[model samples]
Target chain A: MGRKQVWEQGEVLASAMRLFRRRGYLGASLRDLEEATGMHPGSLYRAFSSKEGLFSAALDDYNERVVEGRVRAHLRDAEDPVAGIRSFFTSAFDTGGGPEPDPGCLLTNTAVESFSVPHVAPGVRRGLETIESGFADALTRAQAQRLLPEELDVEKSAAQLLALYQGLLVLVRSGTDAAKLHTITDGALALIRARNATAKQADEEEQR
Target chain B: MGRKQVWEQGEVLASAMRLFRRRGYLGASLRDLEEATGMHPGSLYRAFSSKEGLFSAALDDYNERVVEGRVRAHLRDAEDPVAGIRSFFTSAFDTGGGPEPDPGCLLTNTAVESFSVPHVAPGVRRGLETIESGFADALTRAQAQRLLPEELDVEKSAAQLLALYQGLLVLVRSGTDAAKLHTITDGALALIRARNATAKQADEEEQR
Candidate 1:
């Protein structure tokens, strides 16, 4: 790829990500890509090879640019690993509140869309794995610091957190008025906080 | 629609539901629909109006036949309401273990797919509402029967359960053998079980 070609590829991938996120992998057509990227069908095919190829690139872009970046920030920035887990959620799913056009998570959307499009499913699954491991790593760090209860299952908690995160995205897609997600997030946080309390109680017991 | 046409419509909707669940709304094309339902494009269009029309009907069929039926069974059959909630998860997601094709939930798939297809989003949202409210109602009943913690936030717990349910579906779709989903379910059940223990303690305190 030449400099201009590489730059154009980046632009096309970025645009395709937005399009796929808004309109699912199968929903968006080649014409739609042409319109979004200002490239004719012939050029788009030559560049990305196929619609599946373009969608795969877009999903990779999503993983690298959006999901991985967030994971890096949340995992690296926070001194407290558990707090980093909490922040990962509040930021990924902040939604900014109220009824809005919440598309939920792009990777999650692809995960669901993957069932239909086998060619692109692997990329979507990899994206989910990246997130699951990222969360599990932070949780392991929390365990190392004894921030979580000794008996607390880090892997399980990580999965619980993953479910809560994706589930909330599913709920938010509806644009409901009730504070449904608020309670869900608080409940999850409470579970983590409860572990913290248990750890503290254990520490006090040991001190005595 | 004639009696024969109505029967055919039911069969087509049933087949379409499976296709949509597997292929998603946009991923499966008209030809795919015909292949699934054994109907020609002209017949399919005449019967269902359009591809979107067939998809909408399939979603409704899924809502009525699959989701609502499970909600009814779990809510009505189990006397212990919390256990009913537990059984609901186990039955709805019993993939029968090992490497199998677990499509997760059709409603959840549509919920993810709903971000793009405007016509089908409402039905998907309604299906979620049905589950959330069903869980909430069961919790409410559990509280009235003193089966759960009196102070337990039924709505919040319901929302948390919602997140857990959808999130597990997302995880299972990836075919990861991390035992991630197991912990999520156990952790969620523990939260409810903790409430039960709390209720028992409260009862003891009252007697004392």
Candidate 2:
């Protein structure tokens, strides 16, 4: 493809991503897609094949740009991995006091909206697993640095955090109060820290 | 209305609930509703007013029957409130080894699928709050009975549990392994228990 064609495709996917994120998979009609993407039906079909194809491509774009981007910023690169995970959760509900309520994570919305949609299921699973594994890696590092307890089950805690992450998104989408969500997030992190302290104390008692 | 009319309304709502649970608010078309409820479009609109009206009614019916029924069975009536809450989470993924995957909680799905939907938002909020308050009530009882630590923050813990519950349903809907979900649930419950134990031990140490 020429440079202009590549730029146009990129623009189209970005527009499609916004529409899908806002409206969800089933909610975004073809006409809505056309309006969002500024493409005629014939051109859309010629370019992306079908609505499902377009949606699938959009999901991929979301995973790469949004999902992986957060992982890189908050988990992989942040100085404090555990705090990074908390920051990741914070970002979900930090709508910047915008008039529009948070649209929520695209991967999470897709997971809830298109669980049985075959074309989109793989991308949904992949995106979700990315976050789960990111948590696991971060918790593992935290434990290694003695930030978390040695007895902490990194894998299980990671999975639990993943659930908490998804749950917060669901609540945010439902227009839950940000303050309440922040309390819940704090409670979860405190549980982890409290558990670590308890474990460390227990180890000290055993040594005595 | 006649007795037959009342019975038919119940039946139609039941069918509509199942379809909405399966397809979500936006995914369920009028044709799907017709096929699910065995009603023509004219009859459906006449009875429920509009597609949104039918969905709203279906959500109300779900809240009354499924949400409240579970609270009655697992939280209100169960002998052990914390265990009851556990059972409630268990029921979300318990498909009895059926060929079909679990459809997930209707309120959680709606919260994800139709957050901005004006007509359906209230029902979604009511249904979700019902579960959150159920957890709160159950936790309060558990703390009163000394099954939990006195220092436990009932409200925060309840909100966290609510998030975990919704998160588990989202994962289940996305076809996460049942065993993994069970592990996550177990981890969450164990954290509560462990925290309680730690708090109790600290109190004992203080007395010494």
Candidate 3:
């Protein structure tokens, strides 16, 4: 076997993340990790010293490269920044694959479970901030190009989007049907677009 | 203990709920419950039987009392249904104590951590459904009073409110300060009101 096949660090972390997403920190055990990742306990520990350590590393990797990437990748390929934002919400909230929605963003799951738990809180906070920054960055670029209105509060709006994303995750987890998510995400993005248009009109009127 | 105190079988459940709120189910333990509630393991088992049973009871109580009561209480007192919703979102997102806001809403935390877990999913669903029904009931009442336009979709709007509320909880958990939440909440409510006004105006215009 090739060295890459022997050392499946990314693959192992992904499996652990799925478990963490389903069962939280205390909910998940080392044995669960072993079962999910197909690694012996010794092999898992050699890769990640403790369960907490493994979770943290998985979160960092997922946030930077996977979850944030999902949003960033959407923004990168879209011709219209507005369309990008719109599509981002759709993909994030709309449960496409099944009758019942899957659990929401794993990062969100970790954040909710990490509140007073010190071992996991920092990692969760860091991942969320990174995701927030990514949204703000995209928004900033969109505004500079005159796609988004001048008076739009990107930071607050970004915060709102993050909240919106988190809330949708809760909805999906609670077994809210895909149709419910579709409407909610639609209403949110509609408000976003309408508000920007209204702000721009107000600015133009002020200039006149 | 006073005679009234003798009937407080639910106090231990309250303590357990607080612990579950502060720390997730897997994070909170029988030992933790013993320390927090000052009940011996035998007394606790006599009262609740198992950790899962205690959680089930505590969650049921919270949904019926705290989460549902908060929303129904808002609707009960407001002059306008929209105003009532604004107040509901404000209070639901606010954690009562904490120097920096420790991610409020027990229902939300439970939704995130327990929805996919085998035992707690039903309770979490019940909590969300109760909250959603709060909005639906309020909107339906308003429609009966001719406050919302006839063409307005009450079921859809309630679903949106549910989505928004859940999303806001995620926002609260993700460390959104009140100021940020207020901004988003205001934007959302204003849009709802503006849309209603627009639809009414369109009806008047069409009649002319």
Best candidate per lDDT, number?
2
Write one digit per residue (lDDT tens) for candidate 1, span B102-163: 64677788777775567887788788878888888888898889876677767667767877
- Runs of candidate 2 exceeding 4 Å displacement: A1-7, A98-100, A194-208, B1-7, B194-208
lDDT of 1 by residue, A30-87 (tens): 8888888888887778877888888888888989988888888886455788768766
Q: Report model 3's chain A TM-score.
A: 0.80
- Segments in model 1 whose C-alpha atoms lie over 4 Å from true places: A1-8, A95-100, A143-147, A193-208, B1-9, B40-43, B97-100, B144-146, B193-208
TM-scores vs. true structure, each candidate: 0.82, 0.89, 0.81
Q: What TM-score does chain B get in every candidate?
A: 0.83, 0.87, 0.80
**Chain B TM-score of model 2, please?**
0.87
Task: Between candidates 1 and 2, name the one with more favorable lDDT.
Answer: 2
Model 1 residue pairs with clashes: none
lDDT by residue (B1-208, candidate 2, tens digit) is 6435423878899988887887787778899889988888877887888888888888899999999999888877777887887788778888688886766678888888774466677788898888888888888888888887877766767778888888988888788987778766664565455453233443442231
Per residue, candidate 3 scores C-alpha lDDT tens digits across A1-208 of 6355475778888888878777777777888888999999887777788887888888778877776677677665456665576567677755466674453576677767765445766667677776666667767777878876666667766766666666777777666677677666555454444453243443442231
Interface RMSD of each: 7.5, 6.7, 6.5
RMSD each, Å = 6.8, 5.5, 6.0
